[model samples]
Target: MLRITPRILAVACIASGLITAACASYAPTPSSDLAGTSWAVQSIDGQPTSARSPSVEFAAEDRISGAGGCNSFSGVYEAANGAISVRALGRTEMACEGGVMLQEDAFFAVLDGAERYARQQDRLVITADDGRALVLAPL
Candidate 1:
């Protein structure tokens, strides 16, 4: 046998309403902006890439692939708590034209040093421990 009490029912309704509102107030998911995004590098360490625009793609499940201005590259990346680490990069040895090689080298160096990242409006900014930064936007 069960008894219905108005006070108990009212308390349950209030708790349910609060839970629903809390869920709705949460921030938007990062996957919409990060995962599967084709981010192209615009600047590194406050200097322009000066060659071909370097690009990065964050694949699902810790995989990353991109072109570093000259050569095609693939790497592993992990992000948690707004911190990121990039490693295990492998690239094709295709020769670069003019200053493209320099740009590639610099790009890799900055990427290797990435420790954290932020999304600013329409851009993705990756920062290093030494105050260097790499700025990227959707390609």
Candidate 2:
């Protein structure tokens, strides 16, 4: 039989309290002000996109979804202040023509390397560490 001694009970309570405090302190930070905003890519890497420009939508749950010129992609994004990151990106595996495929690849590359973002009065620019950028406007 297991006996509950005073010392054992005290240790267990202390451990439990410590665990609870740690868990509470580890809660996720608040979402960014960009939450719930949506934009359509107007230009990528300083060049204009074709008629079928890509789009991006930022959801409140740290989710991001968008078109990649030829494929639809979804991923989780985290942003704090002006810095941003994208991870867990998954996309459809559809094929397209040469030019469309090239454009799609460029778009995905920039997103994969996203480092910072800014919102101007009527435009949003996402920039990568290597200086690649995506300029978008409201959808």
Candidate 3:
């Protein structure tokens, strides 16, 4: 028969409690800075653009608001443990000429796959697993 002495049972209970506490402490807290912040797109692949870069700003709650070249856009954002997902993005439909449309499309594409984000001073850096980065400054 398998037997556990009182001391052994106490030790096992203590170990389990310690592990639970450690895990709870290590869990990530939802970012508060992400709310009410405006970020101006800086660079993609380390190249600067003379054209006006796209910008993203967040609301106080689950909404992500931004500008895509000639139009304003808004969406919902969900993030956990460095992974980000955007959904229900609704943008104003405006006719943008030439490069503006192209830039907007590219900006949306990158944001759709954002995996992680970091803050550097007044700047925000969003990155993907493939080493692609989008640097932005607070507006």
Candidate 4:
């Protein structure tokens, strides 16, 4: 026969609480600060990037510089309270492989629409106003 005593119930509750606290400690927390951070594009809109991936550096003075997979680009960005906006982006016009150019175009489009960003663990995800997302990994 089994008994359901108050002591057993209390021990079970404590065990559950301890387990939850352990898990919360290990969970990924949102990262702070974007300046001086650099990352290489891993994917855009859930599509994996190629070997020559676009890269970005959140430089000082709200300036951002990166390779657009085919061309280098620079722009100014504003980030505050989890919201982000990229603007005035300009890129070199050098020609590249067709696939690479297409990828660059898509990347630029997403940047143009960027509205928010989050750094989860090692991944930095920039999401657009239209729900498109760019996933990047530390460089």
Q: With candidate 2 superimposed using the best TM-score fit, by how many Å does residue 58's alpha carbon deviate from the native? A: 0.5
**What would the per-residue lDDT of candidate 3 be over residues 57-122, giving only the tens digit for each residue?**
876666898887788888888765556667788889898887888777777777776778877788
Q: Candidate 2 has which clashing residue pairs, if any?
A: none
Global lDDT scores for all candidate models: 0.84, 0.90, 0.77, 0.91
TM-scores for every candidate against the unseen true structure: 0.73, 0.77, 0.68, 0.76
Q: Candidate 4 on 1-139: residue-level lDDT in tens?
A: 8898999999999999999988785543323388888999999999999999999998767888999998999999988778999999998999999999999988999999999999899999999998999999999
Q: Which stretches of candidate 1 lie over 4 Å from their true place?
A: 1-33
Candidate 2 structure quality by residue, lDDT tens digits, 1-139: 9999999999999999999988785544448876888899998899999987888988888999989889999999998888999999999999999888888898998999999999888999999999999999998
Candidate 3 Cα errors over 4 Å, as ranges: 1-31, 129-131
Candidate 2 TM-score, C-alpha based: 0.77
* Model 4 lDDT, residue 129, Cα: 90
lDDT for each residue of candidate 1 in 30-82, tens digit (9 for 90 to 100): 43336678899999888887748899999776778999988999888888778
Higher-ranked by lDDT: 1 or 3: 1
- Per-residue error for 96 in candidate 2, Å, reads 0.9
The residue pairs in collision within model 3 are none
Tell me the number of clashing residue pairs for each predicted model.
0, 0, 0, 0
Cα miss at 71, model 2 (Å)? 0.5
Deviation in Å, model 1, residue 125 alpha carbon: 0.5
Pairs that clash in candidate 1: none
Ranking by lDDT: 4, 2, 1, 3
Report the error of model 2 at residue 117, Å.
Answer: 0.3
